[model samples]
Structures are given as structure tokens and as C-alpha cells.
Target: MPAVSSPQPSATSQPHHRFIKISRYIYVFREFSKFSIWTPHVSFLQSLRRLAPIPSPSFFQTLDIVAENPDKFRIVGLAAGSNVTLLAEQVKTFKPQLVAVRDESLVNELKEALADMERKPEIIPGEQGVIEVARHPDAVSIVTGIVGCAGLKPTVAAIEEGKDIALANKETLIAGGPFVLPLAHKHKVKILPADSEHSAIFQCIQGLSEGALRRIILTASGGAFRDWPVDKLKEVKVADALKHPNWNMGKKITVDSATLFNKGLEVIEAHYLFGAEYDDIEIVIHPQSIIHSMVETQDSSVLAQLGWPDMRLPILYTMSWPERIYCSELTWPRLDLCKLGSLTFKAPDNVKYPSMSLAYAAGRAGGTMTGVLSAANEKAVELFINEKISYLDIFKVVELTCEKHQEELVATPSLEEIIHYDLWARDYASGLERTSGLSAVPA
Candidate 1:
């Protein structure tokens, strides 16, 4: 994943200052917003204003809104990649009493950086660190920003601690929804959506009964290959596949976007997040990317969430749910629609995006099969990025792995069984060589 830069202190400010370091707030706001591409400077500035303030003796401490609010988070657990680093910087602004990273190396880095502070938060290390962060005395919510299925275990652990989850990792629910959802219910913990699409659907359905909804309309940018013909996918190069039209994201997801596998995974996520069936969840090609998602009511009315494709809006909401905090972003261009002239939608071409169909099949198969499907796709994408496989071969690897593991599929897999199947799929995909029995060509 592409990591955002850590918020630095200004030249004149103390190194331990919690305020986002910038010589010029407007300049930093524009540059940071433009560079992220997903969130604009205008909205970002407003969002920063909305954060709960923290009081400090330093000149910039007055700008630290995170500490003054009692409802503000005081302990955060982060993992996965670069996004974790960026979020860690923001979390520090709140002066969290405890934070967790995935490894000792990160612990060392945090220790060195936070050493100058008057009160350094406790930093925990390793995968166990995630659970520890959640179980901290003051911990109220766990922001799971990790990528892939690695997020599954810690998330379950956090829920077991009775901590609410602000979930950014889609694979957690995609592969382990059957197990995780039940655990959440038993623990009485809320699973909030951190992804923009699911957040939109969650917001739209807030006051309505589940039965009142007819279907979910998930909008897709059609990815880097959206404009390419089905036959041309065989010739796709890694460079070509990473050219996402709207969002700048990690390589795996960007490639998944190209194959429509991301949307497929989202379909499975939507199923678990909203209790929707496979048939009722739909994908549409909305190239403009203005509307994040839509929900159709039984009465034939569609409620759509429209905004500029700024991820911060959703992330902010996930952090402060059931309450809309004040932010300076009321004027960001993403909130403006007049400049964005037209909006259009078309049916997704499953022929061009085979991963789309494969996802639905995996979702319907229901059991450890989804884990198998996710594991296979993750390995294939890694192989493609490393130049060991063709873009088209990504789908082929997933298909073969799913087929080879058909007998291994369990209708209701225990958490241990799910992990076992996930590992098996990884080994199965990684073991596929050019000389292996499976064809190297895309199916």
C-alpha cells in the first residue's frame, strides 16, 4: 500500500508537538490533499478541525483538539502497511495513552520518536500487540487498518474484548464473515465500515428496516482495464493494470480493481455487513465515480450517497459515528457537484472482468471457499506484481485453487478451519509453476 507521509513538526516547533507540522496550513492542506488524491486539502482541513482537541503547554497545543474531548479515542491499534504509518501520525495528535504496531522494528521507531514527549504512550509489539491495544484500560474502539486476511484474528480478538471496530480491512469480513459476525453479536460490539462504499450503504440504510431494501448498487470505476476489450486482457501488463482512474491505492487492491476482484470482495462484504443475499447485491460501471454507492428500496426508490471520491469523509464518520463532527471541509471541491456536469451508469461486463463472476461463485459456495478464493487471489496478485505471472493468469490461479480445494470446502468452518483453508490455498497457489498441470493462460 502507498503510505502517506508522517505529519512533521514545523521548523520552530518542538519535536514533540502534537499539532501537524506545517509552515503554512493552507499549503500543507492543499499539497497533502492533492497528493492523497482521495481526500482534498479543503476537506482535510475541515476534518482536522473536527477532531477532539488535546490540551498542551506548547504554542501549538491549542490546536490539539483530540485531547480535550472525553469521547475521543485514547488507544489505537494499527497494522498492515504505509497507511498504518500515516494513521499512526494522526493518532499521536490525540496523545493516545497506548498504541500497537505489528513488529518490534516499528516499536523501536515509535520509542525513538516518542521519547521526547512529556508522556509517551505505551507501545506494544507484534500481532499480539493488536489485541493488547484493544484491551487497554481506556481503549474504546479498535481501528483495524491492516490489509489482507492477516486482520481477521486480531479483529476477532478485539471484538471478544468488547471493543467497537472501525474496520478498514475488507478481507477480514470477506473471508471470515461467517465466524466474525456471530462473534460480534455475542460480544455486543459494533462493526463499523471504514471503506467508502460500505459506509455509504450503511448511512443510507440507517433508519430503515433490512427488509425495506431491495438491492445494493455498488459503483465501479471499471478499473485500469475498464476501457479495454475482453480479448485484450490477455495482453495486460502490470504497468497497465496499476493505472487506476480514480483512486490511488495499494498495488494489490489496484490490481484487484482492474480484475473487478475488489468489487467481488466488496459484494461478499456487503452481504455480511448488511445481511443482503448474492442476488440482491449488484455492481454497476459508474466511470464518473461521483456517487460512492446506492441502495434501492422495496418501493422502487434509490437513495444514493454522492460526494467527491474523498476517503477521509468515510474514515472520519467511522471514527465518530452516530455523531457528525464539525470540520472546515464544508467548502471542499469534493462536496461541490455543479462543476461535475454529468453522471452515468452501465451494466458491468463480467466477460471482461472474470474475477467478478468468480467472487459471486465463491460467496455462494459459502464456507471455507471464500477464504480459499481470497488467499488464491492474494498470491496470484503478488506473483503478477513480481513478474512471475501474466495479468490474466491472476484469475486462472484463483480458479484452479478453488477447483482443487472443492472437497476441502466446509459448510460452516470453525475459525481454526478457516485459517487452515486460507493457508492451504496460499500453498496451493504458490506451488503452481509454469510446468504445473494447470494452464498458464487465462480462462
Candidate 2:
């Protein structure tokens, strides 16, 4: 699992933090609950008793049965960078049949990454290269990681296949929730959260009447240039943005940490995930990144999800829903010693980081704006990673792309149309007025 680490360290390391204790207990429960499967609530409660190494054999075995049962689970993984290995390992361990669609070269590379899984657990496809599932109808699910439209098709396929989703991609939901969510509801399927921030929001909203949710607060680490002068941002090098102070992430997301686009998409995500109006969600730059997200109740008290900014911790929780269970994320004390400092919260500086407002506007505009912005940001991040653009140009390209598409209709397009919009934004941003103008990739 990709670690969902926060971007900024605690300013004052404490010997102990409450989040550490809670996550450990939660981890154990998620692991054990997988076998106690028939009754998720029982599985959830049963896991609470085991505190040591999680129950790998029984838990994964239960999952294996589901993988072997085609009617139970149909699995798919969207394109991503380093995390593809984790996805492969997950498919191998869980023994789920996997589907991946990308450039042929990438799929071949992915096969190579998981070649070791084949040798070990050895899920050999028949001579025809097809792994058939078992009978008894598996209570299966699909996984998606849509950074934007990149993973949209795979996500739609999995959802359409009647697989409840483990959604890591916020863009799919944010851009197409109006259509996608209704479809899930119609099929009586659930969209489980895999992003820590959104998962935290999902966790907090449970057992409460929907009407009681007043608002949600999404936290951000404010990236590499949180306080760097706006005037100086255009010159920020790849290393500078990639140098996230708190989180260890893929290089592209680390750059996004600097731009606040991750949090922006989260805002849109929260809107769809909870059915909150665009204005109902708030953004706070918590340099500490300890509080993944918070929910405000009708009574005005704010309940927050605080953890050690770890992604797998939440991903495991969703695997066994409606109950708090344990998984691999719970092993650490988070800090072996006094480490995390006092958590701090601040309002974002919109002038310095205009992308913040742009995301909000895209969400509010409520059409293909979110899609365009997301696709544009993907390209900008790509350009930045390839040294074709600077850190500042990312927001510029996204903002421009969004501005170009703000007036687009709000209706959900056929999968083909979403792909079309995605491609157009990437092309449009490539022509953005960067002084570097293809001369400088942000090295």
C-alpha cells in the first residue's frame, strides 16, 4: 500500500500523540475482520482483540475465495506510477483477477513488476491466460485510482460490473459523481473511500443523520512553497516542490502537495462523497497534517479524524466496512519517540496560490470544469516531472484549462466524451504561455 504520509512534520515533536494509539487498534481489527467476513460487524469487533501481528493467513484466504469467484469480485487497477507494484501485490495476496488498461508498454512493465508475485503465490492463468473465479458468489469489489480521467474508464467498467468500489481516485467521483453515484445507488452498490482525507470524512459521517452534517474541513500540508513568496514561485525547481516536509509520496503528488491541487480535488470529492453543496466544505492548511479531515455537526462541534497521515491505514478500514477493524497500518507507534509537534491550522493564502480558488470555482461551476482542471493539472504535473515546466506553471496550466472550460455543460458525458475532454485539456495546457516555453522543464 502507498503510505499516506503528511507533508509537513510536527513543529514540536511530542513523545506521544493520540492518533498513534487509535491507528494501531484500528489496524488489528481490519486484518482479523476479513475472515469473520459473513458478518462484517462481527469481523470488525473480533479484530479488536488481537494486538500483535495481524491475521494474514485466514484474512487473505477469505479474500482469495472471493478472487476465485468471478461473480463475487471483478478487480481493476488504474494507471499510476510507483504504486503499481503495490496494486500488483494486493491482487496477488488477495488472489483477485486483475484488469489494467494503459499504453501497452506500461502494461508490459506492470506484468514485469508483478512477475515476482507469479513465482511466489503463483496465480498462473490457464494456458489461455485466464484466471477463473470460484462459485458461491463472492462479495467482491473493484479498485480505482483516478487522478482525473486517466482512470475513469476502468472505474466505470468496474462499477458497471456491479463491483462496489474502493475509490482512490477523487477525480472520478468529483467530475462524474452526479452520474456515477446515482448509478451505484441504482445498483445498490457502495463506493468505499480509499483516500485518507475522504475516508476520514466518511468515517466521521457514519451513524449520523445526513441532515446533521453542517460542513467538512479538508486539511492540507501547504506543499513546498506554503510560505515562499509568490513572486519567487515561478522559479521553484522540481527538487524544491518534491521536497515535501511531512509526506513521503510519489514525486508527482509531492509536487501537487506544493500546489494544493490534491486538497482542491478533495474539496470537490467531499462535495460528492457527502452530497454537501459546494460551499459546505472548507479547506484548512494544517502544516502538521495530523488531522486528515473534520466534520462539523448541526450543533457546531467539529469532529475530526486524526491519524499518522498514513494511507494504508484508511484503505484497510474500507476493505471491511461498517466496522472499525485492523490491518498492517497499525503496527507503528507512529513515532518511536517524541517526534510529532503541535498541530497547526491556517487559512490558505489565495493570492499566493490561486489554484485553491480555481478548484473551488471549478467545483462550483459544476460541469466539466472539475474534469478539465484535473486533466490539465495531470499534464502540468507531467510536464513538471519531465522538467518541461516549473512548479508555478502547474497551477497556471490548470487554471488556464479550467478557465477555458468553465462554461462547459454540467451533464455527465459518455465515457468517450470524458476521455475526449481529458485529452483536450492536456493539449491546451501544453500551449500555455510559460516563459520557459518548452525551453525549461522544472529541473
Candidate 3:
């Protein structure tokens, strides 16, 4: 039997900080290629800082990490819209070369916000600007932090430009895996996982030889409703779902956790990232979230990456791959297993969370089905958040939308088809609220 290779030390003599930028999408971009774009929004920034030892530091704490080390990193490009003041601060502090907003109307708003700044970045409006940032000539890595299918095109543009992707957006793999994976292979672009679970698995498998991996065990915190009975789910409210027990994240992701759709999406992402068959991947409820994820080898040896629920480690590894960064123990607390009495695990209840089955089936269906499943879920969550659909209707909308898309499922989708179906699924899922008789549950 071949021996498992241990991780090697960094080849560089000196530790150099690479220019890392934030993007609003589910990803972050950094230097390596010609141009790279980053746009970390308020929720993303908050999510990154939530698990830190500090108590509610300023909202720009995430970007401050990059700003502190000016020599190691540069802010090249950014995309934002929701919080103009926050965006203005980022622009003022980092002085990125290019900026992109949600739309043309917000362009002036951002400009006016940056009026006091001595150097202003050229602001481009809408999706085109985002694509430009993704494919920026100077960027070596692009972080796909944008939510949903909105991230697919920009990520593709970045990959086409030969930028390594620090993928925070699960939808990129869940939806665009069929198309994007091939594109990455063709361009020699590396698709690195930034999510804790996927990054844990990625770290565990780093030195393992090909075909040695047997099974993947994805750990879940079980979200806010983990302890609630199946019958109690229908009574769940947006605020109730938003109350995550472990991680403080954006509304959409927090809701995804409560539904276990986040885990479901991660399952699909694992399949694409590690080429594991859906049957080979398993989900276990680990309430503590201490062990991010684990992988089993052919000999049944389990390798797991353990860390505090903080997202910084995983995101940091994405940038410093092939080289581990030395983080001060003060800011980055070391995990103390002795202090935590015990770690617990259990099999997830399928009856309570239908997202697992839906995601697996869509993954098995291949082609555009996974994308449809993700888009539908995103739309369904939106409806539930708006009180336009009952909590239970979230599952119904996704299942029904996937069912309706069976006929049009493309086995090997083009980029255009992927985008088309993404938009189509969101539209179809939204229509189900009216046609499928889904009513909002009273708060």
C-alpha cells in the first residue's frame, strides 16, 4: 500500500502577505493573475468577525485585516451596493482600482459617499462591472463570495482569466459545477474551498494519493432548529430560523442552516470538489462544530480538521495554501479540547429536513438539476423570509420546481444554459407561491 504523504512546510524563505480583497458574493479574490475583484458585504464581513474573541468590533473588521498589512496585500477591485457607507469606508481605506455596485442608480450614491476620498476608483454599475472585476488583469485569485447564481458568471470570467478561485459560494459548485469544473480544468485554475466544512475536507485530503479516499463525513451544527421536533418546524418563524446556535451569519445562510439546506448544498459541493459519489458522502450532526469535517481512507482511517467555529482559518488557508500562516495566539485563539467536555454526533433526521434528499437526488440527476435545486431553494428562502410563503412551503417550492424542471434538465449544460435555468428556476419557484397555494404562516 502507498504511504500517505504528510503536509510539507512553505517553500518560501520569508512569509509574504498576498494582496487579498473582499467581494460581496460568497467568495474573496486576491493577487496572482492580472486583475481580481473582491466585494465582501456587511453580512459576509459580520460572519467572518462573529466568531472572533473580540466583542462586536467595527463592521469593517474583516477588511481591516487586509488594510493592516499594506505591503502583503492590495485592494484591487470591489463590488458592493447594500451599504453605501460601509462600501465608502472600504474604498477610502483600501483604495481599490475598480468598484462595482448593484446597479447604475447606486453608482452616484457610491460616488457621493467617496467624495471626501482623495483617490476615487472608477465605479462600474451592474453585472458587467462585476464581471470586469472578476477578470481584472492583476488578480491572481478571485473569491466567489457573491450569493446564488449571480456569482457564476463572474467566477467563470475569473477562471477564464486564469485566476485561482477561493470559493465561498456553494452555488458555484452546486449550480455551475458541470460547466465551471471543466472550465477550471481547461484553464488550469484552482478551485479552493473557503467554507469550513469543505475546507476541512480539502485540508484532510491534501497529501492523500488519488483513489485513496473512501468516504466523506460532513459535520453539521444542526442549525437553530436541530433540537425541535419535526412537527414543530411548521411553526418556525424567520426570526426563529435566524437564531443560529453556533455561527452568526447572513440571513440567507442562517435560514439555510435551520433548514439544513446549507448542509445539503455542501454535500453537492463535496461531490464536485472531491469527486465523491453522493452515496459515499454522509452527513452527521455534530452539535459542537469543533470538527469541521472528516474523510475516510480505504483503510478506514479517519482524518479530520478540528477548529473553533470561526471561518477565518478556512478563509486564511485558501489564500495561504501550500504555506500555513503564523497567526498570533491572541487574535486567533487556539482550540482547547480539554475545556470542552465532550463532542457529540448523531444522524440527521431526514423527515425533518427534506433538503438532503432533494439535493442528493438533484446531484444524481446531474446537469442542470443541481442548479435548479439551488435557485429554487434561494427563491423559496426569500419568500419565507418575506412572509410570502410558509416555512413548510420552502421545501414544497423547491421540490415542485425541481419536479417541473425534469423535462428540461440538461445533462451537460453550457454556461448560457446554466444561467438561463438559474433564472428560470427562481422564476418558477416564485410563481409557485401563487399557483401552488402556498400561504404565509402567521408570525
Candidate 4:
């Protein structure tokens, strides 16, 4: 880890006198002294209403930012789940030309949201709906948000359509990198990374000439169990495992953080995203998550991207690549150096978090092996979440499944071949849960 440079300004130069108030997506600057500020009673209640944390607003924030410059960027298509009624209503606000949803039951609800529109958008439903949205003639880019190997097929479809990809789903690259990468190259479309860490690496090396880059340093939050001793990990409960220290994410991902498999998956993703060798891409546990990721040049200078851990910026960067758009709605404060206290980095303990090593092993092995690794981890995470398996069993399942797939490892696997290995590994991992012994859990 390189020495972290402090970003603090001198007391005279810094604006510390004004008190900071942050709501879900807005920052309110006011005088620190209550007597100096004027507030109306009705406005005070409205401010209180805005204080509740917004429900996962990364995608919506991107939309809102794009909405500001409707001419420069258009929200022509969408694919989303949950709050379909609300999402559709919002879509009506943007009034995209097309909309897609996985839940067929919500189609009517979506229609109701757009009932008032004079020119209702085309509604596409189910799996084909996802592909249609990706391949829509009006669509210029695809945002892959679906989880696991499920995202790979649609991502491929979007790539074939020559749609630039804003890759939020890590599994697309993890399970199907060999096929996806080639497809992207053949189509000559950009597969922009939307993950914060990967986006940070992308931002760090954006203009720098290739080959001058020596290594990619991915920072990890070290997850829920980072502080636990080696022996304590086996006893970790599912609820306990879901408690990630830094990021607010889905259960599967949260558990992945606990096992360090999230970082492991990122290791493979970074390998494909940046074309860095598995040996060259390294994971360092940075608990702060302030510095998203770093790049080491051939001359050994390290360039890093630092910000508050907000997904909106990264997602926005992908959508507005080559142009940094001003996103006023995402009004979070910038990283203040003096308040940071410290940014720490340490090499991961491979013995405790064997998933990290398994990722490297899978990357080194290549082909369907990485697919198998991801599938196995997904299955293991599901079982662990269901409480059918213990926390440490996550690593056990991934390791066993990957070892079993060594015989099935194929170089340059086709899409179907990758899916085959993915399913095989998932089943293998699930089967291991029944017969796996307590002794199999790593120390």
C-alpha cells in the first residue's frame, strides 16, 4: 500500500464555520449558530420528511442526472424490479420510449403508472423483455444489474446489438469473460465498468497509455468477519455474515464480503476489465473504502480515486464516459482529509479467507474454471443464507466445487459451454452441502 496523501486544507482556507446537514440525496449548508438561521415551521417538517434514507438510489440518481440534460442523454429504455408501480411512474416522468420488467405480474401495474401518457412506451415482459430492452434500436447502451450468471446472456445480447455496456453485474465477466470479452472486441463496443472499485481503476488509468500500467490494486472493506480470528469464522451465523462493514448491498453480496469472495469475484472482474494478469491485480483490505481502487505505473507511481462510497458517481461516469456530467442531485459532500483520520491497507490473510486464493486459482486455471468458481460461490452463498450451511462452509463448497470442475475445465468456452459449467458447479456445490462435514470448514 502506498502512503495515503492527506487532503486537508489549513483552518483559514477550510470552511468549517458552516454546519453541514445531509439528507438522503441533498446537502444543506447552513450557519452553525441556530440564532443566525431562519426556518419556517412547515419547511422544518418538510426537511424532516426528507431525512429518511432513500431506498437504494444509484440507478435512479443516474436517471435524475441524465434527466437534467434530456437532449444530451435520453432514458429511452429501462429494466427493473421492485416498486414497479413507482418505477413505472418515474419512467413516465422520464417517459422512456420502451420499458422491460422480469415480473410479468407487474405489467398491468406498470401500465397503470403510464395511463395518463399520450404516447405510452412499448412494454416488453419477461426474459425476452430484458434482451429486447438491451437490443432496442433506440438504445445506445445496456446497464447489466441482474445478479449472478443470469446477467451473462442478456449482456451478450446487448454486446451483439453493439450496445455499449455499463457493467454493474460482476458475474458477467466472472462466469463468461472469455466469451463476453471476445464478443465486445468483435462488436467494437465499450464494456464500461459500473462497480465503484473497477470504475476507480478505470478512472485512474483512463488517459494513461497502455503497458505503462504495472498493476491494479483493488481495495476491499474486509467484510463482516475481517476482525474475527481464524477459529471464530466457522461459528459465524448467517445473520452475522450479512453484516458488511462498509457497503449497503444485497444479502448474497454481503455474505460474499464476509467470505472475501466479493473481492475474489472483483479480482476476476478486474482481470477481464483491465486485461491485467491475475498476478498483477492485487487485493488489499482497505477498511475505509474511501480510496475505491488504485493503479501502479511502471515507474511505481500510484494513482487513486478517492470519494465518499456512493455508487452514483461510478454509475454516472459509465453512462457519461468521455464526458463528466455535473450531477447536482447527488449532492454528497466531498471527502474531507482532516476528518478521514486514517486510511489503512493490509494484505489479505489467505489462510483465513481462502476464497481470495480460490479466485486467483480459478483465474490462473482460466476457461470454464472461473465460471465454475463463480457458480460454486453463488450456490454456497445461497445455502449459507438459507442457513442450510455454516459460514465457513461457503469456502468449503467453493473449493470442493472448483476442484471437482478441474476435469471439466475447457479453454475458450462458448456461451453455452460456460452456462453448462456454471450449472454443473452450482449443482455440485449444493450437493456438497448435504454430505460436507464440519471438518471440511477452513480454519
- Winning candidate number (lDDT): 3
Local error of candidate 4 at 2, Å?
A: 32
Candidate 2 residues lying further than 4 Å off, grouped into runs, are 1-139, 327-330, 334-341, 407-410, 433-443
lDDT of 3 by residue, 1-443 (tens): 11112111121332322211111122222334232434345221111211111111123444655654444566677777467677777778767788877666877788888888887888878878778777766666666677788778888988888777777778888989988988888887877787789889888877676677767789999999999999988788888989999997888889999889999889888878877776677788999999999987877679999998887677677666655767789877998889987999988888888888787788888899999999999999999999999888998999999999998989999999999999999999999989747878767
Worst 10 residues of 1 by lDDT: 33-42
What are the clash counts of all predictions, listed in order?
12, 24, 33, 0
Per-residue lDDT tens digits for candidate 2, residues 151-171, read 455455545555455666676
Candidate 4 lDDT tens digits, 1-443? 11112211122343322211111111121211110000000000001111111111245555454445544544556666445865666566666666777678888988887788898878887868766766766554565766777667777887787766667777788888888887887887667677788879888876676477767788888989889899877677777887877877778888888888888889888878777766567788899989999987867679999988777667666555565655454475667889989899887787778887788778878899888988899999888787788787787788888888877789899999998888899998889978838333222
In what order do the candidates fall by lDDT, top score first?
A: 3, 4, 1, 2
TM-score of each: 0.79, 0.72, 0.87, 0.81
Give the Å shift of residue 248 in candidate 1: 1.4
CA displacement after TM-score superposition, residue 313 of candidate 3 (Å) = 1.3
Ranking by TM-score: 3, 4, 1, 2
Query: Model 1 Cα displacement at 315 (Å)?
Result: 2.1
Instruction: Predict model 2's lDDT versus the native.
Output: 0.57
Better of 1 and 4 by TM-score: 4
